[model samples]
Target: MMKKIIFALLVLVATSASAQNGITNDFRFGQGEDSLRCIETITIVNVNLNNKDYATAYTAWKTIFNEFPVARVDTYTNGVKLLNELIKKESDPAKKSEYVKELMNVYDQQIKYLDKLQEITKSKLSAGNILGKKALSYIQYYNNAPVDTIYSMLAKSVEMEKGQSEYAVTERFMKYSALKYKQDKSHGEQIIEDYLNASIYIVEVLDKYHASIERSEKKYQEEGNPRDSLNAIGYGKMIDASRISKSNIDAYFINSGAASCEDLSKIYAPTLEANKDNIEYLNKVLSVMSMLKCTNEDTYLTAAEYALAIEPTAKAAMGCGYRYYKKGEIDRALEFFDQAIELETSITTKAELCYKVGLIHFSLNNYGKARAYANKALGFNNKYGQPHILIAQCYGAANKWSEDDVMNACTYYLCLDRLDRAKAVDPSSKREADKLIAIYSKHTPKVEDLFMRGYEAGRSVKIGGWINETTKIR
Candidate 1:
């Protein structure tokens, strides 16, 4: 009977596999062939360890581990690193500790080779296949975390791995097989819907901790400033206040100024511990970024690094970028902005940041760079009035008059009219309004030419004649 049940289970599994071939085969569930082999070896190592085949397991593991000499390169080898860690912590009284020590020595021996490989691949974060940027993030996260936190974080890393792999497969299919998929509207729509759903999930997860604008407002009242850079406890208190103020853990903490990234992380880490789910996605993003810090140039890159360590997201990256920009570190600013824009999906937010970068470039007199940023800002969101005005200014400076400049001029005047109307309706603006009109009237050539120009133009003889005539009329 047991044999019959096992046969039935195998039949069911085969049937399910066959059925999946027809449910729109756009996504690959697990690792590809090459990576699968590595996963299998790691699985064997784990299973052997469980079976008390420690000697045999060590042999399989050593061969497997040696294959990925750069222990930090990808997830599989990183898992081997974790296995090494587990071996070290094994507390069986009868166990030979030297065996674990030997395993670690093997890992150490491979370290220089890994470091050399890291140098070659450091500039390239994402590939089109399985080991993309997000996978790298998982590897880095697992490498850095404490043991307890590492276990807790594994579930997130798994989710990210699935999402990233599925996304890669879907992207490849769309690029390579769009015609085949396009014929089926239902399948196409389902693919789009699923992608959108994943994007929304990630965005909401990031925004969940975006924090309240009101938190700054409250801090300004409580401490008479936005933050205190001097006292570490003050920063920690600010993070606590932000979390406790909201019943749901939706707002993220941001610590700006002289505080290093680690300081910010330490201060807000308590909040992260209190609200784990919202922070999980960010953790993965931050982890991968920390490993790539050798490329960063800003003084606060370490602080930015810390934020990614605490909670990885485009928001934290943007915060770091704005700081770098303020410090006149243009290249570093651009680096963070590039990362932020690629990760961010919000048009409004992206447009706002683009405008800011444009303004920064404009301030630096990098007109060409400024124009590029301004164009990108407009492309992202055309409705923003300030970007239109900025582009108009850019064109005016270049002595190139285009249709966009004229349109922007009209927009500027229309905006001013609306603002003036609003001010006119308010009692407080009445005095200011009169003062503005007095100044506005002087510069308004049309109004001045119509009323004052002709009067001034033909007045001399008439003025003397009017003075004699006025005396007689009175």
Candidate 2:
């Protein structure tokens, strides 16, 4: 036992001396008593941090921060928490700024030590992820930092991460781009393109995030454990911040006036053919062009043609509908319109699709199908009054229901009934409805003629021969 104690002491003395000489230089923990103290203090700092002892944690955390920059990456991670606490508790603006600046430096140092982290702990850290977090922290703490500085960092981070972007960075990149645009309208051209990329990526990432939450919930259900579910909630909250950011960027882009058809065509048309086989590229062009109401542009037509030839997206289908409709292929256009409407999820958009198809049939003098499509539009969105106007127009333009002029004039009741409904559901349609009412009411049959026809003026009448709607005799 005496020999074993002496051997152990020798090993300890050798270890302390080797550590003093910087055995590997992977980290900056000190030598002898200081090295041991740093280790113990770090462990205790984490314990205090975990137990909500921020004050104690901060005091010990600074020692690791200042002397052990090369220590474990957790040193920097914990430093962030400590610095954040200091910044929050600080009453003096100068002191708060100092802490915030130190926090930013901690991120930089974390990046610096990332390559050395494999020696101590497993770390798959990427510069992209760290820079993204740094940029977000800068935004949060630095008030309005230089747009150019934020933009440069955010752009690199997003380009590096691609689809797996830190969501806030992707969102704020577009947002700051908007601010830059306001400062210099010349920035609008690039911002329009930036909005396209950022919006698509953010949407894709959000879908993945939602899918993760769903999987987590499913796993928790099977296991009867809430741990994964709780983690999912935390993850979802982080992504949810991007949701508001997404909305802000969307509003900014829409109102930027940079999405005019000519400008959109210039941006997208030059590359449409080369990207013809690129389904994702085709869809991007179709989506952005359609969003900016560039349907009349040749870029939209070529993109839709390319995308529809490859794989039909919702916007691609809608664009093809326009293509065929303008080519006088009404049947083909309606087919694509029906496909787009089915693929779309929004009720208002579906209504708009149906009404548009109804107008096409009306233009072709197909009143029966026109009214049919119009009624379908109203079914989708009952508050939509334009379809009602379309149906009224169909009734006014239809052939005589009877050889007797009086009986024929009674069709006016059907037309007027649709007009009234249009005015009732949508007050914005009142002017158009009143104008049609004046034209149709002039053709109304006298009460005596209705009485002679065995139809009371106040009773219900079913119009026959294509216009089969129920209406009261006026």
Candidate 3:
């Protein structure tokens, strides 16, 4: 017995000396009895955890956790898993609540050693990641947490991580932000702020991960690996899942309905002076405002011109176009507008810019050019009702269809046909289309006039000029 006891003491002394020298692994298990105790306890507890023996794991877990708190990140991670299982399984409310609090402490203790763990090991852990997990834990187990509590945690995490933020956390942050807006209309500006920030990074992360998969597939294909097709298909499914999670945030933003063009102009105006020099912030501001169709606002024009001075963007050009257009500089305005169209890539945005330029031409009473630009816009987006509306208006404004009085009267019929087509392709245009239909329906040729002109109800007649159209002369 004496020999065995002395051998144990020597082992403790050696182990303690080794720990003091600095360790590359085994985390913060420390020296002497503490190190041995943690090693043994964690081993036994992890076995129990893996075996679904929570009761045994719980008994041993606390002793090591209290004694050697920083033993490893895995210690805390496993603690959370079993605690969650316990909480989920527990029928008794009071016991379950106590377990939840203990689980909270595990996260807290992990944070205390966060930096130290990274210093000692190759842990890629970050403060933002830690806080994000805690926030998710609150959502999972402590769900009654106040809105501000969850919102604040998520904000810190998102700001810290940016494009590094996990899609799950970003998605949750936007969801809670929408809730915040729903509960109080006063939160609209804040919601818009969060929306812009979160959206920028969410897309970035999606692209990054997508690029990773592509690179991997390309490498495998170049190696002529038989698993190449299977690997790409499998990885593609993962990216698709991420896409769904990231996209939910945008859907939530729309549901919030917080930031419109006019509202954004008001919200961002005061901050422009401070943010003018911040190129990234200014670009984001310009992009957000442009997306909201706030391009016509004075505040938007200012941001556009300011951003242009720092870096020329499509939004900036578009904004400058509106400014010149507002000042009645038609030639300069069209130049900037064309620049905007050429710089933009999205089909929808290009379609909108074309429509805007078409509207500009219509304002100048250049009916043929207006129709030409309107047709250009439709070529970009066939289902775009606004361009169809513009074309119909162009025909009506021209008010000339060959010098025949009967043909001129028949113009209303063709105009009504375009209006009907507009509403058919896009339901959102139905109200405006109906209004035009109501106004022009009264101008159709009377039955006596049609009879005298020898034009049957179902007879198709082609109207020529800038308004070249064929329709039945009903």
Candidate 4:
């Protein structure tokens, strides 16, 4: 473990000094009591290192100590101390490299720690905050927010903020409060009250930082990059420190985790509504939302409608529409199903649509339309029981009862045998043996003569039915 740590330090130093010699000694930048500025500077330096821009690296390092005296900020003091050590040990190129690595490792650690502290401060002053565990996880991954988790974390923060003002003043709690403020400005004061001083200071810092980020972000926007879509979503309009903090929840969602479609909607909804230009992103999210089934009926309809606008043939949209139809929302259901049928080319899907349309017509008491639809459904899937049933109803409704109807019903019964040949299954069908007997019983003398004739015929043919008919003793 010790060697691994040392090696990591060495790598940073080597990378920092590889392009030029004695660059470490010239490095010095500090923030005098401006922790936010100090962190931002370090982030900029790190960015320079990432791009391998040695000139920027050298300039940024010199600016750190020269720009701000180390006496004012502990973070700057430690940063300077680490950098100075690298300079003094600059005799050995290899050793200097190790020092560079150590410097980078320390810088990264400080940035992460500061970020956490800032978040805590923001949460403490606010109406709510996430758990320390989750915040740590987010910092570790640098990924998007886990949307489902935000709800739990926010609820927990609100509960914590209410219990003790001191607890609320903590950095984590302050971050939570800021987030809540963004979600609903009306509740900002309640949460922001917990850490008044930190809240005030961080607000100013965030303003400077937010502006810098925005300016830099604008360049990316000019290129028509699709990724800028998230930032373009109305995060800019929210300026209150509290709202800014709370809205970071949306940032966390988009940046930190793999979220479902519904999750994306909740996060982007506010921003998308505020900025009409973000409609593209909103539509994208809505597309996914349409595919997702929610327990809430209203949400399903809303998502389905929006999704159909993007993808007319989406199965989820059709399903939602069908549900609406089942629940008596005929117009809405028809709209969805019609789109699905128009867009889908699969025979099975077409059959399903036909069946649904027929059923809908039947429910509306449109017998002629119902018959037409049922016939169309059967034209594609003659063996499907529901369509067969629909056809039967259509005939019965038309008062067109005939022997053919009975035979058709019998064909449906035969279809059941194909479903499971081993187990004889009937969909509430009554035994027809007695009915057959009654029909035969009506033709007494004719039946008797027929029986006698059948016996004569069977005697010559040696058939089973002739013997059965010839048994007149009964």
Best-fitting candidate, measured by lDDT? 3
- TM-score per candidate, in order? 0.27, 0.62, 0.61, 0.25
Candidate 1: list runs displaced more than 4 Å.
Answer: 1-303, 307-313, 392-474
Task: Give the range of the ten consecutive residues with the poorest summed lDDT in model 4.
Answer: 462-471
Model 3 accuracy (lDDT, Cα): 0.78
What lDDT tens digits, residue by residue, belong to model 2 across residues 9-64? 44443335334322355325656665666666777788899998888998888877
**Where in model 3 is the C-alpha error above 4 Å?**
1-14, 17-27, 184-186, 224-235, 269-281, 293-302, 314-474
Global CA lDDT computed for model 2: 0.77
Per-residue accuracy of model 3 over 42-116 as CA lDDT, tens digit each = 778878998999989988988777766665667787888889989999999999999989987887877877766
| C-alpha root-mean-square deviation, candidate 3 | 11.2
Candidate 3 — which pairs collide?
none
Clashing pairs in 2: none
Quote the lDDT for 265 in model 4.
Answer: 51
What's the candidate order when arranged by decreasing lDDT?
A: 3, 2, 4, 1
Per-candidate Cα RMSD to the true structure, in Å, reads 25.7, 11.4, 11.2, 23.1
Error of 2 at 185 (Å): 3.3
Error of 2 at 239 (Å): 6.3
Clashing residue pair totals per candidate (backbone < 3 A): 6, 0, 0, 48
Model 2 worst lDDT window (10 residues): 14-23
lDDT of 1 by residue, 1-474 (tens): 645643443333232322221113321111233233444555666777778666566666665555534322442344445445556567773453554445445444434343344444554322222233333333343354343332223323324443333332223222212222343433443333233333333333223222332344456667875353234334334323322322121111111111234543544445544443444534433432232222233323444555555655665676577667667887998788777766766664576678777887777767567767866975764433455445434433442222333222222222234235434322333454445445433332232432442423223211121111111100
Candidate 3 lDDT score at position 176: 89
